[model samples]
Target: MKTRIFQLLPISAAVACLGFAGQANADQTVRIGHVAPLTGGIAHLGKDNENGARLAVEEINKKGLTINGQKVTLVLDAQDDAADPRQATQVAQKLVDDKVVAVVGHLNSGTTIPASKIYSDAGILQISPSATNPAYTEQGFKTAYRVVATDAQQGPALALYAANTVKAKSVAIVDDATAYGKGLADEFEKKAKSLGLKVLSHDATNDKAVDFRAILTKIKNERPDVIMYGGMDATGGPFAKQARQLALRAKILSGDGVCTEKLSDLAGDATDNVVCSQAGQALEKMPGGADFQKRYTARFNQPIQIYSPFTYDAVYIIVDAMKRANSTDPKKVVAAMPATDYKGVIGETTFDSKGDLKKPVISLYNYKSGKKALLDVVTM
Candidate 1:
């Protein structure tokens, strides 16, 4: 049998000996879990998330970290949740079964929120780099965390920019009806009302629905200055297109959910003058953003999105916590996480008592020529 031989020495002398073989074996494996919609409606987002997480692991292992005095290698356990909550739950349970000490994923709040409870129950630390629903952390789960600011933050900022900067006197609110979409819509409506902007209409649409002609017609009649959408690019794109088709002259405003190159493709000519407030700034804003974008483009042969940088930060947080705790034991790393304040690619990251990021930044952007250009930094 292959045996880990430190040195053939007396039992008393072996106390000082290093078990080289066992160290090598143990050092070559550090498992982390990720769940995202790898092959569903939001596959583009999932692909970006998985690639970002993978890149972080690559960078970490390249640095050659030592844990418990043994060289550590990162191993990812990825699952396709398909942007479905039930599937996300299954994946979370699977990760717990596999005994992953940490996880970074479930891009959508709908999926992340449900899966988070499972991770909390299992004592696994879960950090969502993109899920922004305020309720995700409000569940009082000690193990749940997010790198992005909540929708509550993004919603008000977007509404304020619309009423103040965009000079809108009246606005219409539309949501995809999911937890993420509806929550953002509610916050935006509340803020817009407080800002003295008349709410022309509030509507809900299924994510899979493409025909928004009926709703667009009503919005056109209301003559709102802007129509704000609380949903991802998948639905936001169609809404923009239908608005233009129905000759609705209202300017479009959306939250981070609609901030993607895919939105322009979905909006086509309707993309012009569309404003959005994202969780963070553009690639140029991050200290490492330019380099990361260059490397990410080189590796993936495509442009990166807003959430990827946060996901990169999430992976590093896990690694840093492991190093601080000096062990991969889930409990130790979890305890050490609060003390972590690492300068990651996404900027200075630190969490609050509720596991939400503290002082997270938001940025406004205007979509032009199939790309989102940063307009201004929106502060709390």
Candidate 2:
């Protein structure tokens, strides 16, 4: 009788283990997708943003969250949009088809703006860390939002600086023809003209173009006191280099798009004295920048870039929203977003009625020793 009981106990334990395994296989997990230009001209910046999102998931899941009375695991699904709007559509569709609970990004404003429509229709929440185009949220898409202030705000801030600080009387505008590029160029043009500055010339360039001898030559003749580039580093770098080669010699200014190490690589010595506006001041200057920077460097084995702090904050914002809504339902998560003052790595972040960041600060930087460092902090 004893021997028979022992053999039965072993079989019972095996059955219990199999049942647990089956339940685990059927367990529901919360998944989020991140879309970026992982393989193209902006791949490095994309990778930085993607890593930030992934780090957020890793830290959140390690805490072992429970939603709806069940254990929840946060999973990250990465997709490459190649910084193209058409490809952004493909990547966004893939995320929706995969049924992720939310999405963290489509980095560029051009890609983010179009892909947002798809996410809006599908009822998926998207929070962009770096897409600053005004039209991104102006379309009245309830599910689309960004953590950084728009180019509409930062563009004019730079224009004011050009007129008031630099005392410039003439300015030239250039754009790469993307949504982010054109919108900012327009804003600067409007404000620069209002400030009684002469508009030297406006020209368009393709993102793939590496040569800008023609554009620089035209600007040289016009002789603007300053040149404002509304484009990313890929073209901005070469334009800076070519401008120097052509002896245009105008002071160059760019937006957050050109705030990267790649600008130095592109322009080499020509990157000197160039200025741009990015989201926040150096980590050492912010209230908690020091601690966050330490952790980021320890984890990633490198210094943080422009959008990583925003992306890091984006993760916590979503997590906090999920907790507040008491659910991971996309609609509920979004509804809770604007009401919360999310204290993220960048500082206390709050959204306005338009789902845009309200009066967030912008920091100015110039190239020093081939790196971008804080010059001044501007409130916008």
Candidate 3:
């Protein structure tokens, strides 16, 4: 009986050793959610944001990081919101339910605002790469953070630039009627009027609308020196293209939403007439801009869009918080995030009390021969 018992114990010990070895070799996946408009008019920009996050995840996994004394692998839970607020909320909840440690998107302000509540309720960290509405961070949600300046800053800067540099006497405004569009347009109008420039007209259009002939014709009658648009490049580009087709000579001005490489292709021959603003420093000015562009292009086989660098930085910021907390738990990461001060591809990043970036910088840009040219940087 003793010999039989010894034989059984050896078999059990062999099985246990195999199990332990397998567990040691396996990596625990830590999911990080990424929400964006991956299947709509602005899908190109949305995909660009996702690609940035994915690149970071892939690189981090390659390094074989161990957090909490366990080999951990980062995973991306990418959800498509189609740039719709309702869809954004749905996906936000889904990501929360999926137990993502942090969220890095919902690119449009309209979507980001609604989705932020879901993340806050779940106590997950959310760092938007492109949503610039002031209301997003002003709501006192501890979980909310953004890498870009708010519309409160971007709108006035563009308006001031138009007043001082463009020397515009009158400006016509058009918005896509989304939260981001109307909000930015309203801010621009306030500053433009304060600067003593006449606002000839302010028109609203749906984002899905492609024809701007009616509005352009009416705007031409006003004969403004500048036409400012508050919307994404998906709509803003066509708006400029149509404005040029109607033979309007007014220069086109817009906020960060319309500032992207895709704008030139979307606007085609009319690209040179458009000048836009971005919420951060120009790429040339960012510490990691050149290396980031090289790596991003190599990974995605595409040029970096306006918000890619921001999203990339956002991913790294979340990881920074996770490492600081020494855990992949969402609550721990959120708690560590308020103190984040990471130097990233965009520049130095530090969030204020309201989750808004401190010392925000804005860059003015124009397109020439299908290339985006930097004009100036305004720091605040």
Candidate 4:
């Protein structure tokens, strides 16, 4: 009788172990990749984007996730591309190899454009929170999508503001020579010309360039009414500062890349001479902007830079697709993205055939007393 009882105990123990194993198998971890320039001149902006995604991941996990009736945990696999195109591709490949279900970023157009191919090849959905280059979506990569308006929309808006609002008849164009900068400059130049604004001169400067005196001197000589700089704040700020120091009274107009809260510090008092366009609505105007700002500040102990709200929405958008697809598989998620109509912190987001926002908003900003002031919001 004792031997029979011991045999039954062993069988019961085996059944308990099988139950534990089955429960473990029912729980799955879904990896989502987020890439940005975490260690560079624009690292602050990159960190902001990453923090937004991280915050969303934490919130989603806390709320609990279930896909196909199985419990799931979301993990954010953040990577740094340093805003470099080459490094971005490398990071993209690594994420692909790591089998991330989807990706949230590659902030700069230069990096996003190059890295997008890798994501496309891997059949993973890639959403850019801040990359505004129109080419990012025009590449025919079904995997590429952006939460922000494209440069196509932003450039013309900036050009229209420069021509009508600033009352500028002539403008000089300068680009950082990267995919984002050059593309935006080109679009602005085309629209500026169509609007009957004379293009005084167009020049190219590398993204890493700090000394814009040579170019500014050349532009100053031309004496255009507005100096349109298509670059990030890292270069645009100093460019405006030097232009002011050189006594160039022309207002500096730029795209979303130069539109940030940190621009005030980088450009100092000269920020007043700058007018920039953002590819999204102003934070105050967003549906959940105020609450998001409060939560983001509390979590990161820092102010939102530019694209954090968009990044936050990007993560939610991805999860929304996953839920609709009822699968964490990248291919299934991509299939569900086209039907996305999720309302998030940034607002209602829907994609066109090209994966660009169906209805996009562009906001114009200027600095007054070293503070960013919203000038106008344009919808297209």
Clashes of each: 0, 0, 0, 0
Instruction: After superposing candidate 4 on the true structure, give the runs of residues whose Cα lies further than 4 Å from its correct spot.
Output: 1-25
Worst 10 residues of 2 by lDDT: 279-288
Question: What lDDT is obtained when candidate 4 is compared to the true structure?
Answer: 0.94
Residue 295 lDDT in candidate 2: 76
Candidate 1: segments with Cα more than 4 A from true spot: 1-25
Best candidate per TM-score, number?
Answer: 4
lDDT tens per residue, model 3, 28-137: 88999999998978899899999999988888888877887778888999999999999999999999889899999989999999999899998999999999889999
Q: Give lDDT tens digits, candidate 4, residues 1-380.
A: 99999889989999999998898668899999999999989999999999999999999999999998889899999999999989999999999999999999999999999999999999999999999999899999989999999989999999999888889999999999999999999999999999999998999998899999999999888989999999999998899999989999998999988899999898899998999999999999999999999999999999999999998999999999999999999999999999999999888999999999999999999999888899999998
RMSD of 1: 4.0
Worst 10 residues of 4 by lDDT: 20-29
lDDT of 4 at 208: 90
Q: TM-score for all predictions?
A: 0.93, 0.91, 0.94, 0.95
lDDT of 2 by residue, 47-127 (tens): 889888888888888877876666788889999999999999999999999988789898999999999999999988899
Give the lowest summed-lDDT range of ten residues in model 3: 61-70
User: Order of all candidates by TM-score, from best down to worst?
Assistant: 4, 3, 1, 2
Q: Each candidate's lDDT (Cα)?
A: 0.85, 0.85, 0.91, 0.94
What lDDT does candidate 2 reach at residue 3?
98
